[model samples]
Target chain A: MRFSIQQPALLHMLQVVSKAVAVRTPKQVLTGILLEADDNTLTTTAYDLELGIQDTIHSDDTNQLDVSTPGSIVLPARYLSEVIRKLPSDNVSISVNNNYMTSIQCGQVEFHLHGIDAEEFPKLPEFQSDTQIQLQSELLNDFIRSTTFAASNSEVRPILTGTHIQYTDGTLNFTATDGLRLATRSTTFDDADTHNWTAIIPSKSLSELSRLLPDNDTVIDVQLTDSHSLFVIGETYFYTRLIDGTYPDTSRIIPKVQRTEIRVNVKSIASAIDRAALIARDRDNHMVRLEVQGQKMTFSSSSPEIGNVSESVEASQKEGDDFQIAFNAKYVLDALAVFDNTDVLIRFNGSNQPFTIQQVDGDVGLQLISPVLMR
Target chain B: MRFSIQQPALLHMLQVVSKAVAVRTPKQVLTGILLEADDNTLTTTAYDLELGIQDTIHSDDTNQLDVSTPGSIVLPARYLSEVIRKLPSDNVSISVNNNYMTSIQCGQVEFHLHGIDAEEFPKLPEFQSDTQIQLQSELLNDFIRSTTFAASNSEVRPILTGTHIQYTDGTLNFTATDGLRLATRSTTFDDADTHNWTAIIPSKSLSELSRLLPDNDTVIDVQLTDSHSLFVIGETYFYTRLIDGTYPDTSRIIPKVQRTEIRVNVKSIASAIDRAALIARDRDNHMVRLEVQGQKMTFSSSSPEIGNVSESVEASQKEGDDFQIAFNAKYVLDALAVFDNTDVLIRFNGSNQPFTIQQVDGDVGLQLISPVLMR
Candidate 1:
């Protein structure tokens, strides 16, 4: 195989696909990326059994392409990326001999790496699905950002480690929960179909795609099968295996009624909670109490050994009876971070009950965290 | 202690001095910073036996002074710093009650911390030296940056972990070595004092000070005692205990004569070495070979299992015979990072002998590294 490519273009493509490379795999070839150069297009693919990524670069349209032979090989992702990034020249020339010894040259620098036969690398699963959905990249990115963090970090309850995604009646919903907290986001689709599809995607896969999502308003096409899902963005393809269990029904857990509600500036309340957390962090449960009276919300925490701290921020608006509640400070902070707006509406059912926080002006996304019983 | 000070000012002072706080000391009071408020100033001090820092904030000169009572108390450094940084107001009011309970208030925020009795805190050692010298902070910081990296990270040889500093014959010399490599820097002081002094300051202490040193050309006063040294910059005082062991003689290891010399652009060679390091890093020794032939210098490294890589760059000038030598790429990279100039002079004595690297423009700082035997 012989190919000449622009260094930056190749480096960017390699970086986008290398995210799927397995860090520790029993099979050494699983940690490599399959590079195939044919005609005017070069494709890079990486699969780690559970997740896979494929990105293609067109040399003919983008720049110059001189390919004497068309072939494929698998190279270690990390070493290849490093060499490509550190090369001294703008253009890099790569060629492979019959012995699978690849030579990469750029200006005054050259690197020779032993490549595994591409046939030995596992191929990405083909997308064989009739259900197809198209959405804006921005919308997809927001869905991942809002729901993924609440997913369980442990694998004891395998289903809880994934984000439940469902499309029904022209509406798309994504929910993630770890029993302690749940994040749910929904948006209505323009095109309605008779088909109802649901899938539980591991949070790790969504996070990798989120990192590579473009900021521009590009359209992303998603295809789903019974056991696998695929996301196609521009010249890139991302595929991941679905979790094998059913997600728990979380609708009954959300409070049907709220006795008290408070609207406060997100930054003000977040900072108050942060300071109170400094004291609570030394305690066993990292708990902080919040009390609302009139328009002032007081945040406080106390540790027998570290002392106590209290801070109050004025609520923009208040309703119903004044209330007091206790919660893990970190959970509240994580919920607050998703909001890009100035104000957030916080609804409380009662002390020791779960509370819901949502954007002040919108109800598309909401976070619910169960309160800790005060000792 | 009672004082109303600017929050940012107090926070900055605490951060600078808090580095000396012992995180897990046997004596609990050693984990706190002693705060003393007087008629016109608020002083903060932290001593960890080996290192001490004291900083004073003048209220009369910068802001209004309203101290109803003058007292001293010790507050936990990490908690205090975090609270101060997160406070919402610009001015922070601190007051100690009769029971040594400290109240810190800023705007709508208040923190109550249980403080230790200031009497239990250890006092910083006094500097009783009559011979004092003043030097530019820039010069002091440069001396530290050039020599500290060569200091041994292990405590097996205690003296090698400290940077040896000596003032002799109007020249101030700083040297550090870990047996494998040595770095030395010196500058002539204009004031010829008859009193000569030598001390080994712990690299950790110097590194901490280097992080806080100002970039401007400010004069810093230095005072030396039998076992301690004090540095005063404005209202801040930094004290560190001197290492007790004698430094080894490293002058003899630096080659006085060279058989081969090469001058190259620092960036060009450093980048080449960085690329070569990608392959060598997987090897046991992380060794890279440099071969100088005519005006071109080739950098190469190989791993039996991972393959090999080589890159060559043109040298600006060359003298004597061409030679090839192998050394740890990391050590060479560390030595090259200290040069601020575009060009560097690399001198080689023989295949296995130590070589020197110095800035092409100046002779102040020099680095010597011994070659690794080829397999």
Candidate 2:
């Protein structure tokens, strides 16, 4: 198999597919990206069992390939990427001579790499269900930003490490939780399929895929199976395995009725958290206390060795008795930052109860942060 | 003591003085900066025993401070600096109540901190030296860049970590070596103190001083002692201890004879080395080899477990005959980057001998890289 393509075009496809190529995996082939050069197109695919990425690039010239030989070879992603990026020219020639040697040539620079037959790569799964769902790229990405940050990054519990995406009738909901905090985004999908579906995809894979989705009015095609889910946009396809466990019901953690509802400018609240973080960063627990009363709020944090800080701000809220609550400054800052709106309504059930924060007029998403016991 | 200063000015001075505070120094007190507020100047000083930096900011308004309440104290550099950076206003009011507490107030935000007695800070040595040498700030900085990179950072031999500077009459010379590579830079001072002087200053301290030098054409004052050197420029004073042990005689390592002399574009060679670095980064020993044969030169690197690459380039120097030498790519690239000139002349003595490279124009600086044996 032989092919000649623009260096940039091939390099772009390599970077896309190489995301699935793990540096050190149990399976050696998972660490390499499989390249299949055909008559007019070059397909690069890579998988690490949990998540896989496949992309294809079409050349401008039909003469780019001398033969229509459909053969595949697996090459180390990192090294192959380096070779292409350092090339001195726009177009690079790539050829495979049987199973042992794959040569890449550009100007006076040439690289001959030893490669394994593509058959060694894991078999690709077919999306058997035709019940594909579609959503606007921008809205879908917004849903990801609202939920992905709350996902448990530490893989102590594999199921919690995945974000649960559920769709039914005309509604689409995405949720992520790290036990301490839960973030959910829900919206009406005008083009949603009638079929009921739910899948727990690794939050990291969705975060990475969200970056690759098209912008603006472009639509993304999503397909779900019993074992895995797929997201397709243009020439790139991302597949992630579904975690084989039931996601915990998070509805109970969010309060249906808040004892006090305070509306504060998001930027003002975010800045307060940032200032508190300077001291919080030195503490062992890294917690900051937020005490809300009638029409005033106090932000305070203390480190035994470094003294203490307490600042107050005039805030608008439902007239009620005062209550105190403490939460991880890191989480509060992150949740507050997700809103682009001018003001956010922070609702609380009590001092020890989980708190819900949402944009003043936005019921599209909700964030719940559990309070830490500040002695 | 009470004073008010702009936030940005305080932050700027904090960044420079904080550089002398090491994160993991054995003496915990050395991690704090000594702040002395007196009259019209606010002086912030930091010392790590081996090196010291003190910088002062003058406030035009007498309201910032009163000479009647002259005071001195030490506080953690990182926290104070971060607090000032996160303050909500342009100007901050700092007042020391008694000698036990320090308060910084800005807008509605206030930060209180415990301060260490200024008496605990190490005293600055009274530099008593008869020989005084001065040079352009840019020129002194240039000498540092030319030779400091070759200093050994290894703790096995503490003396090798210093760069030796010698001044006699109107000529000043600097040199550093790490057993393998030796670099030297020299320049003439217009009015030197007519006596020979030699001292070895830790390269790390000199590096910090080099970066902090002002970007102006004015000459910097140099005060030298048998054990320490002081660089005073305007309101900033930098002091560094001199290495007591004798520095090695690196002048003997430079080869006087050569079998090959190559004149090549410095940028092209540096780029080639950077590209070769991709493969060498994964290898056990980060080394790349260059083979010169007549008009062509071959650059190659290989890892047994990975792959190998060999590329040839037509050289302007064909008189080198044939020879192969290997060297650490990182070191070579760093030294080459210091040369801003286009054409560089490389001096070679067989394949095993240490070679020296210098700019075609007499640039006063010379870089040497030793060849590593490939086993």
Candidate 3:
């Protein structure tokens, strides 16, 4: 491959695809990024068998890129990144010899790298399904942020490490749980087709996709196959393998009846729980107790070796009977952090049952945490 | 002890002293910070046997602090810092009961901590020497930044891990080396005393002191004793134990005669060396070769597994014979980073002898690096 491109443009494309490069893998080709120059576009692709990212840059009126030949080569991602970043000039020229030795030149600096043949690199799986769903990048980003944190980090049950995503009618639902805690978010998106689909996407992949998604109203097209899913945003394509097992149904676990409910400012309760957590963190479960009486709620935690902490915040509204519950302080803090609303309504079914937290003003999302048994 | 102090003021004092708190130490009291409340000032101290830091807050015009009773206690540093940081109100009240159970109250929040008696905490050593040297904080900070990186990180020779400092007449010299490279910085300070003194201070302590020193010209008093050194900056006192060993003389390592001299732009050559280092870094020695001929200098490095890289930059002036030498790229980069000059003069004694780098216009500091013998 022989081509000359703007240093900044090439660097940006390399960084985007580098996210999928395999680190310390036995297969050396997986650690490389494939560069192909054809027609008026230069495409860069990186795949690690499980995840793949590809981006393309075009040579247009700006005259930032010039292609002298149509060819392809795979170069080590790490060294290529470093070389491109440290190149001295704005314009960089790259060429590959028949022996797969690549040369990169910019002004007075030149780097000759041993490149592997493009044939040795793995190709990204092609999506064969014609069915495609289009949604706003901002909505997808919010869904990932709201529910992914609740996914299981352990590999005991591999399916639990993924976020369950489903689309029925015009509603898109996202749910994740690690047995002790659950987070669910639902949103309405206009779609003409009535087809429904459900898939389990690894929380790790969802996080990377969220980082690449724009926060604005830009539309992104998503295609899902039986084993793989693909996301296309602008000129970039991201693909990830689907988890192989069925996700457990979590609807039954959410409490349907409430014995007590309280509405409190999110910041106030979050700060109180944070302070209590300082003591609770010394314990195994990071357990803290919450008691609701009249219009006040008190959060307390104690460690046999570190003393105790008690903090109270006034609730804006209270209903039903006064109650007490003990749960992990870290769970409540994580649930509270994803809320953009100032006030949240917390509902309790019983001292031992799971309690749910939801936005007081909107029905955007809900978080449920199971109480820990205390002697 | 009972006191009400502004949360911000107390937090600041805790942060300053907490730097000396021991982590994972066998002695329990070493992990706590000693808090002593007297007349109108609340003093906080933390000691890790080798280093100690103390700071005080007074109840004066701002009235941000109020002392109800005079007492002392030791509390865990990590937990106290977290609790104070998350407290809800500006004014926080702290008191201790006869049982050493301490209560921290702010607004509707309360934290009860098990405190240790102040007697268990190690006291900071008092400086017995009346002799003191006063210098500008900015100058001292610069001297530290110029020389400390050359200090040995390996404990094989414990004395090499400390920076040797000497004061004679009005000149203050700071020097550090790890056998392969040496850095020395000297400054002229106005001192009336004719007495000369030399001491070796641990590089870790110097690094911490550098972080605390202000960049502006503020006079700081430093006292050196037989076993300890005390630095008084405003209302804070920092103490560190002197390394109990004789420091090796490094004056003989700096070559006095030169076979080749070249003056080049620091930024241009630094950038070239940085790029060459990318290839050199794959090798054990991180060796990069530099060749100077006429007014141009070229930097190159090659690895059998990763190919090679070559970069050239123009030199403004060159004299003597043309030469080629190989050295660790990291050492040169670290030495070059400490220079504020736009251009540096490099002098070489021979291909095997050590070379020196200094500012082209001024002689504030000098760096000597030994070349690696290549087969």
Candidate 4:
């Protein structure tokens, strides 16, 4: 089919769906983006089997697009994006000539690219279900940040590689762990209706969706079929298949009580841990010990090759008894960076047991790290 | 060795010398920076054998340096840079408490790093020369811009991997060639020294020195010895060993005669070549053809698998006769970008002969690119 569209509008849609267009796709067709124009909208879709994205744009300048006939074609993603990005951002005329030549004309510049018939493109899975939930764009992005990092990245244990989501009545919960660290975040969804639902979404897909979401305070509609889940933000729709397996009960891995807890400024603790990490990198365990005595806490790490470091910092809380514990510095630092709080309270049950880190004021976000074997 | 220096001053020097310190050096001492403090001046040096840098800084708030005995110590470059960068930009106190204990204190943050005595560090080449030449910093930096890119970067061609400079009788000439392309620029020194000198300086070292030069019109001294060349700018003395063997005769490769010449606007020609190169990338030759007839020139390139394209551009010169020539579009564009003229005259002796790209109105720079064979 033949149709014309504005150059800038087409470029916008290409950027949205081009994320899934792998440079080294096993199937050559997956490297191309399928474009279709009908009525007053042009839709582009790209998929690499594991994940897929579709984006649509509405046009007002019909001259840029004149539908001599209605059909579709798959054009190379990278070349098209480059051509349009270099074009002047004015009214650009784009049309399919001879059902094969895709031409874009702006001022003195003209670009012509070869196109593949849309019939050869793989069909995108049809996601149809009634289980749709609403989530604020910012809050959902934060939820992904808080828990996605803990997901096991290895494909050997496919179930643990995904973040488990549990929802009931008016609340949605997210949990993930990579055996060394566990993270959980839950938020209230006033409009969430259908109760008792659980699904394991791949951490990678969740991160991609979080990065692509708009910065404004808009509501994103999340829907899940029996086997796949869809996240629709603005004019783009992102879909990924659910991990088919069972997730472990991580509730028991985090400590339920604490014998001693201390409140340390988030920035100070983060900086101290960063310095300790420099020395910890030379060690196989990458462990750093935190000793709390009264209101003064000391952070230290040692390596035979890089020598040892000991830093003393003050905290707001001192209680119970003096104690020292060692934990993986990377996991704890990664968890604390996502919080925008002044202070964080780290609780310890014993030197050899799992420890919990939470915001000092309230349990707005919770993170748990399993202690490593350290001597 | 004991000294206290402002964090910013130390960080700046670290950044300058760290450029020569490679992260993966087999000699452990090469990965560390040598710090030597005596009296009121603190000197720092970092070397990777082929290139080295020594910078001295004077500070008042850093105390009297308190050198009980003058000594040298080598410390890891990356770790020191990172630690100093994150520290507050105030006076920092440094002391050696034990044989290996190195402690740095600034505000409430302190960093302790292991250090090795500086006797293990490589000896920097000394420049012993009575003859010296001076050039404007801005001009030297700009000259580097006009020639560095053409130098062959492959280590196998050691001589071609460096920019060759020759000065005699007040005129200083710079030449570089990477086999496929050559760039040459010359300027007259006001001193009118009758001494002749030649040296091959690595392209990477020249570029680094160019970027670090102060942005002013001050004259920078160029001192050359048997095996080392020094560019002492302000408080920093940059040294790089000269590559052995004679540099190729780039002067003879430039064509002195022409059969057909065409003058075109530099910006228009650059843009067309850039666009045409996009399509030419699919072929090994990456050949883009230029046909000049009357005052209009056409640039065209195509692949059998990817369609073909031709665009018409305006030109000002049409001498001798109409002709067509094919050249690697990337090389042609790169050479054109180095020209500061608005319009350039492209001269060709024949369809397959090496061509010269010169400023249409000036003679500040000249670039030559060898034509590629097209099949």
Per TM-score, the best of the predicted structures is 3
Which structure among the candidates has the greatest lDDT?
3
B135, model 4: CA deviation in Å? 1.1
Model 3 score (lDDT) = 0.90
Local accuracy of candidate 4 as per-residue lDDT tens digits, A32-138: 88888777677889887777899977656543555556668788887777776766566665667785788766666666788887888887667677788777888
Global lDDT of model 1: 0.88
Q: What TM-score would every model get versus the actual structure?
A: 0.97, 0.95, 0.98, 0.94
lDDT per residue as tens, model 4, B1-375:
677777788888888888788668678889999888777778889889878888887656543344444556888888778878877678777776677468877766677888877778888887678767887898898789888888997987889999999896777889999998889999876675547888889998999898788778888898988788999888888989888889888778888889888888898888777777777874556789887788788887876656555677888776777777789887887798887648898888777888888887766578898887655
Clashing pairs in 1: none
lDDT of 1 by residue, B1-375 (tens): 788887778888899898899988788999999999888887899999999999987776455546668989999998898888888547788998867889999888899999999999998988777766888999999889989999999999999999998988788899999889889999886676536788899999999988878877899888888788898988999999999977888778888889988898988888989999999964456799998889989999998777799989999999989888899999999999988658988999878888999988976599999889876
Q: Give one digit per residue, the lDDT tens place, for model 2 in B1-375.
A: 677777777777788888887578877678888888887788889988888888897775532433346778788887888888888647787777765578877776777877788888998767777766777898888888889888999988989899999886677899988877888988775663357888999999899999888766768888888888999877888989888888877777778877889888787777777777767854445788898888677777876656666677776664655788888888888889888847888888877888888888768588888888767
DockQ score of the complex predicted as candidate 2: 0.63
DockQ each candidate and list the results: 0.82, 0.63, 0.82, 0.48
- lDDT by candidate, in order shown: 0.88, 0.81, 0.90, 0.80
The local lDDT score (0 to 100) that residue A370 gets in candidate 3 is 88
